[model samples]
Target: MSALLELRNVSRSFGGIHAIRNVSLTLQPGQIVGLIGPNGAGKSTLVNIITGVHPATSGTIVHKGERIDRLKPFQISARGIARTFQVVQPFPSMTVIQNVMAGAMFAANIRSMDEARSVAMEHLTFTGLAAMADRPAEQLTLANRKRLELAKSLAMNPHILMLDEVNAGLNTSEVEQALDLIRAIAARGISIVIIEHLLKVVTGLCSRIIVLHHGELIADDPAADVIKDPRVIEAYLGSKFAQRQMVRHG
Candidate 1:
């Protein structure tokens, strides 16, 4: 399968500090790829560059064989790319259904509001938000907020779903819910790039994982290999990632 999203030699800098340096990755249809690293690892920077939230200082972004490096954020969204923020921002005043209506609007540009609502409704139902459709976004718990974010992104009908730390502050059960939700999302045929520090999620969901440290990709391999990479070990998780390894087997 061909890549639905591709980054070629992409680099960005802020205040003379290289945030991301010559980073490149690909997402194929129906695949789940993980981006994992320590804090300030340029994961978000790369995500911003791809989603057009931050322009690349150099290099190219290609989606569906078309160059989209110069596209604006909305343009990028329109081109079959959608993302969830590490911090979700729902239209708090709006009902759950209404917040989803915003994503439905993406399809509405080429369709109709009625059609969009119908579609958005389906996404909400798919993401387990149907029962709360009448509730305000602000009224949701953290896990539901994460689910709502997933619903919102899905509402755009994106072919590629980019999730930024969707499992940050939840209980074990909540995290499992998130993990299951992501599996269902990918099962629905959307490719995904999950940027997470949660090793369990990465190991569980992604077939492949990329490790980055200090703005550089230090490891890109099968999820298993990436987890065991010594350089990756020293770079991000310190002695703990490896120690965890020993405990898992020992």
Candidate 2:
């Protein structure tokens, strides 16, 4: 099967500083991939580049065989690439379902309000936010806000979903709930690239793991192999700790 998305030697810079350097990777259809790194490893920058929030300074981004590096964010969303931000920002004044309806109208091209509402309700129900559909977005708890973010993204009819720290602020039980919802999403055949700091979450949920360090791609391997890699260990831990791990394992 063809790749769902491809980034070839992709790099991004802000004036004198390079945020991402020559990172190349591919997302296969129906796969859940973990993107992990220490803080300032450029994980969010890479996501921005993919979703067109920040275009790559050099390299190509291809989705379904078509180049999209230069496309605007809305254009990319319309082409079925959707992302949720690390910081959930909903239209505070809008009702829960109305916020999702905007995504349907904007990205899914649903013009009629009735049809948009139908699509939004389906996504809200799927995300377990149906009971809160009429509530104002600002009134939600942190967990529910995250669910709202997911519902809005799903209403976009995405083929690929890039989640940036979707489980960041949740408690353990809430995180578990989010994991189940994510699994259900992947079951529907939407490819997922989840950026997470929680190693257990990544290892348990993703088939593959990609690690980045200091703006470079250091490791791309199966989840089990990645966690054991010395380079990955050093990136997250320290060089001294990584050496101890290597010697102990050997």
Candidate 3:
């Protein structure tokens, strides 16, 4: 079967700097994949390229068997690809539910205000934000705001969802809750690409893991093996960290 999203030799550069160099990967339906690397590894750059926030400097991007490299950001999103930023920026003036409604309104379908609101409520409930739906978005705590971001993206009804550090700044319990939410999303048939620094979290939730080093993909394999790869340890996670992981999981 064809991949839901495929990047073939995709690269993005700024002036003389190559943020991503010929990185290729595929995301299959309902699969949860992790993108892991140290800072400056071009993880966010790759996500930006896929979401059409930045065009690829070279090579191709195929979504559901259709080439999408040249498409605009909104166009790519309309095709059922949605992403959340590292920073959650909810509309401060809007109520929590209204913020989600905005995403539904922006989609090709869900035209009426009532329809948007209904869709918004469904997502809010899914993300555990139903009770707080009336609160001002700005008033939400960091963890709740992250949930809001997830809810808004879900309202867009994406087939492939790319989350950039969705677990960042979340507490231990919140992180566990977020993991459960992500699992539920995948259970519903959404393919997910999670860019995360937390190795334990990635290993726990992602079936496959892709590691990038200085803009190049160094390893792409099952999460279990990828974590133990020597190159991955030397480049991103230190050898000691890898040793600890081995001892714990062995």
TM-score of each: 0.94, 0.96, 0.96
Compared with the true structure, what per-residue lDDT tens digits does model 3 show for residues 1-250? Answer: 7788889999999999999999988888889999999999999999999989999999999987899999999899899999999999999999999999999888647889999989999999999999999999999999999999999999998989999999999989999999999999999999999999998999999999999999999999998899778899899999888789779879
Candidate 1 matches the true fold with a TM-score of 0.94
- Model 1 lDDT per residue over 107-145, tens place: 436367687778778988988889999999999998899
> What is the total number of backbone clashes in candidate 3?
0
Runs off by more than 4 Å, candidate 1: 107-111, 243-250
lDDT comparing candidate 3 with the true structure: 0.93
Clashes of 1: 0
lDDT of 3 at 40: 91
- Report, for every candidate in turn, its global Cα lDDT versus the true structure: 0.87, 0.95, 0.93
What is the RMSD, in Å, between candidate 1 and the native fold over all Cα?
1.8
Clash pairs detected, candidate 3: none
Of the two candidates 2 and 3, the one with more favorable lDDT, higher being better, is 2
CA lDDT for candidate 2: 0.95
Q: Candidate 1: which pairs clash?
A: none
lDDT string, candidate 2, 1-250, tens digits? 8888999999999999999999999999999999999999999999999999999999999999999999999999999999999999999999999999999999998999999999999999999999999999999999999999999999999989999999998999999999999999999999999999998999999999999999999999999899788789878857876777678887
